[model samples]
Target: MIKVLIADDQELIRQSLQIVLNSRQDMTVTDVAADGQEVIRCVRKNVPDVILMDVRMPKMDGVQCTKIIKESYPQIKIIILTTFDDDEYVYNALKYGASGYMLKGVSMDELVGAITTVYNGWAMINPDIAAKVLRFFSQMAQADDTISVREKDMEELTRTEWKIIAQVEKGASNKEIAKNLNLSEGTVRNYLSTILNKLDLRDRTQLAIWAVQTNVRKRVET
Candidate 1:
């Protein structure tokens, strides 16, 4: 079973998440925290596979907590769950190695899928925030050194893999990519896995960033 820790300052939100997530057959809510400090303490006591972390909290906040947790325990996947999609928060959370970023308004199914995706070593970002994320990386890619390094790393991808990466750079889901490429969903997933392996990326989030940094999407368009 995938163990999850829900961290939100609001009691109602925390309790609601715990109840909903705990109802899943494949997951269990190991604990809940009202703030970032408590989240760290709980993680140290009983490490969870995934953490649903709210961006705003009483102390430390989710961004700082993510940095500290990822620094100390890189294996644990963290999903930033928040009502706000502030650009700084999104950029900082991703910079700090968060596995996913999702809004609280998402359905329970999406939440579960995000958790599962992260646990399985893939990244998940809400579609609404995807554009901001892409733009964030695009701006950062203006650095010549970073672009050169990412371009060098991207050379290993095959033509088909490049197509897949282009789709990912657009924030297309696996299903959408499969439909667009006229391949089965399993095939798309397999290609994504191979792409991640070839690029030495941890998950799709890194792959997307690399795609933007290396101009894979622009090349595909042109």
Candidate 2:
């Protein structure tokens, strides 16, 4: 069962989400928080597998909370579920290791699916904002002159590593990567750990962003 934590300042939002999430057999609401501070408190008590975070909150916003939580507990997956569609929020939340970003307007089914997807170690961006994110990343990549340098620096990566990276850029989970590459899941996990260490990336979200920024698959194809 997927353990979930709902963090929203509004009482109705938190209570309503708890109700719906707890009703699902595969999921349970571990706890609910009124704000970012409370979210941190609850997490310290018993860390949940997934967190549905709201962007604007008293004391600390979701973006800052995401950064702190990921820095301290990188294993915990967070999904930014907010009413805001601001680009800075999107960029910062993702940069700070959020695995999923969905607007509050999303259906409960989509939210549940995102939680499962992120728990399994894959990204889930709302389709409404995915194009915007890609465009933003494209611009960010253009301004980043060091991407080529990073590419050259990664020359020691094995062929298997490159294939795994290509699969990651496609948002494949470890299971999918294992099946696609004809490797065991354990082997895939080991490869991922090695790749993260080699590139100094904290998590899969960063790896995927780096892949896009560097057009990694094109290099693999060539």
Best by lDDT: 1
* Displacement of the residue 206 alpha carbon in candidate 1, Å: 0.9
**What residue pairs clash in candidate 1, if any at all?**
none
Q: How accurate is candidate 2 locally (lDDT)?
A: 0.83
Quote model 1's TM-score. Answer: 0.93
**Prediction-by-prediction clash tally:** 0, 0
Superposed Cα deviation of residue 138, candidate 2 (Å) = 2.8
Q: For model 1, what is the C-alpha lDDT against the true structure?
A: 0.87
At residue 118, candidate 2 shows an lDDT of 91
User: What TM-score does candidate 2 reach?
Assistant: 0.73
Residue 198 in candidate 2 has what lDDT?
83
Write candidate 1's Cα lDDT for 1-222 as tens digits: 999999999999988989998888999999999999999999999999999999889878999999999999999999998765566786778878998989888999999999999999888989877887888878767754252235565677788888999999898889889999999999999999988777778788778887888777778778
Worst 10 residues of 2 by lDDT: 144-153
Q: Model 2 over residues 99-187: C-alpha lDDT tens digits?
A: 98888878899899999989987677776666567666666677753233265558868989989988876666677789999999999
Clashes of 1: 0
